[model samples]
Target: MYRVWGFITNYSLLLILGAVIALIWANVDSHSYHTFVEFPIAEHFFIGEMHEGHRMLTLHYLVNDLLMALFFAIAAKEVWEAVILKQGSLRGKKAATPLVATAGGMLGPIAVYLVLAMILGSDTFDAVKNGWAVPTATDIAFSYLVGRVVFGAGHPAVRFLLLLAIADDAAGLVILAIFYPTGDLAVQWLLLSIAAAVAVFVLANWLPRKLDKGRELRPNSTWVRNTLGFWPYLIAGCISWYGFMRAGIHPALGLLPIVPTIPHADRAFGIFAEAEKHLTDLLNDIEHKLKTPVEVILFFFGLLNAGVEFNAIGDPTWLVLAGLIIGKPLGILLMGAFAAHVLRLGLPEGMRTSDLFVIGCVAAIGFTVSLFIAAVAFEPDAMLGDTPVQAAAKMGALFSFGAAIISIVMGKLFGVKKVEG
Candidate 1:
């Protein structure tokens, strides 16, 4: 039993377990699963006398809006450290090729989606066109798992894919912000969200030191610059999350603005990179504390969100599959090759273009964030009431399972072998 717990906890096996359970449960008794997901957490409530704006919370809403905010917070911190802080392979001109390749990853899917949508022109395709961003996301956890399988634990191509996924996530955040908003836009709340993020940044990085003075303190003290010492971050996170929620955007994105502000050691080189040992970066500390909670949250996330009825599959399904499996890899390869020739860039040592090709295949797995985008892109309302376009988008997300198989096969074809730890 202890060994089982250790294995599942070690490599995000719990997350996979959760997704598999959800799929099987939903398929076996979809009505029960659906009812549970939509089950209200609280009774309906109203502020004004007319009860004009009453609201009720549901399980799905809580998981996606609230818990996933932490997930995005972790993602935002990593991206900030990598791209802006020059951590990981995103540092110098030598890193320029991968950065460009990241752009290709985004543009390629979008371009393929558009062309396919145009060719398959109809009212049906037009209705679901907003889902173009769905195929663009790379589930950082699953992609990392597949890459580890394909290229061992420490291959440079795996590092390259990690950086690529981070950059892809940054791009996805932008796309979500710009393209997907709920209801009429609230400018005041948007500004408030920005203010909250800035305040969090300042509180996390500056206030602790000002309060601490120059006194030498034990490193283990909660009052010292550790996780507990940074209580203000939790406050700031909540405020920012509320701000985005009210501003009619996905609240998961609330974490992005505050990440760069957290004090951190300089970014490290390579995948699975570590921060400076002796020095404490508050963001790094927060990430460490969040490790287990994030895993738990991801399990629930997969459980609640991955439940898709087969009837939801529609015209949008094929388009999404094509973009993820075909466009994603092609885009990565073409962009990397372009940069290598035009700008005279080279792959990380012992890495080759063929290895990149396999890495690109791994890039095709999209879930979590992709499902979130699908939900956002096909929100139910008058024009599309009770339709399955949203369901089809989700079906495509589920189809990303095929991308994993493709990666493994392509890895073998390219001579990749499992490395013993």
Candidate 2:
């Protein structure tokens, strides 16, 4: 079974599975299930031995707010590596297609939403305006997985689409930061950002000093034998997250300052490349131990919370879901095909117009980013309580899932295959 999907198995499907379980649990009449989602988990730990330790702590926080920040950070890592260091980096004209798609996808949703708002009148239609920007996205991890499965290596066009999808995600993140950050921006928090930037720069300079003599950062020569490369940055990331949290900027925003300094091999020379390979291995181990757990735990608990009752799917929510799941695919495919044809950019390799439509359908798996948008959509001071907007977002994600299923069916019916680059 794992062989069938490969690692696409993770990402959104895992979260979606949890949600389905929650819905099923909701439909059931079991009282035992109530305690899990309802009862909050309050856990904390000491950093040192009983003699000298500080309490690292937690409480009833929103999963989307904190843990998902880490996901954003991790997702940011992938996109950053691409745009900054990888071949996919879009400087100037290279960014055209994804940039176009990003703008259109986001704006289209707002247009649809505003039309709904006007039809329903401001009060009713505007309830989820924060979510207006929700649909302008394509989840990269999931999209890459889907592309790998449906589009083989021969398909350069589809492969490019996958890259475009990832690039679009990065753009979406920027959009979220610019348009979606709630309320007045805080100066002191921005100051903390500057401080964090300074601290990371200081750390990067100190990396070589911590190394041994006769050893350069090049391959076969390792500078991190002294624990300077990975552990220090990982701990810094934790501290950075905490500080950003307290400083009132979204904690995930703090990740931007620390990455330029992650100590990946900078020298393109051969000896340095070998040493860089070894250092990279060490860094990977460290990231797995430190960062991966942060992301994983956050996801698990987030899922546990989602263990809430799902049977309550009502008319308003279901309709919103329908719009997201159904409307999004239709809107994206029609728009994308027109763009491709009008511009004379060919279809992704091994892909046809039908395939692009299917890809658009699957793009709506809006689990991660959509969830974040939902959490922020309603004003904390609003009347219907903390959840109406959240419910709408969840519905939209569900609708997206449904649309993806339809896309898969369509693809199978039409025979979408991998085309060589």
Best by TM-score: 1
Local lDDT at 344 for model 1: 75
For candidate 1, give the lDDT of residue 356: 68
Local accuracy of candidate 2 as per-residue lDDT tens digits, 1-421: 1122433443445665666675566457435444444344543453334225533222214354455655666566556555665443453444554445444555555566556646766666656555666655665555555554555545553445555566667776676666655435553655555566566656554444454345554432254434455655656666666555555455555565666556443321111012322444433344445454554544554454344345434433543554455555566566666666776554544456766556665565665565555545545322222354555555565455555566567667768765544
lDDT of 2 at 353: 71
Candidate 1 per-residue lDDT over residues 1-421, each given as its tens digit: 0122333354356666777888788778887877777778885663333236766577777888788888788777767767666545467875677788887777788888778888887775678788989989988767877788788776777768877888888889899887897555675887876787777655555665666566576333335454555576677777777778777777778766667766677654433443232346676777778878888887887787777667777778888888888888888988987887777787777787777678778998987678779878887532222247877788888788789899999998989765533
Question: What do the candidate models score in CA lDDT, each in turn?
Answer: 0.74, 0.52
Which pairs in model 1 have colliding backbones? none
Q: Best-fitting candidate, measured by lDDT?
A: 1
RMSD of each: 4.3, 6.9
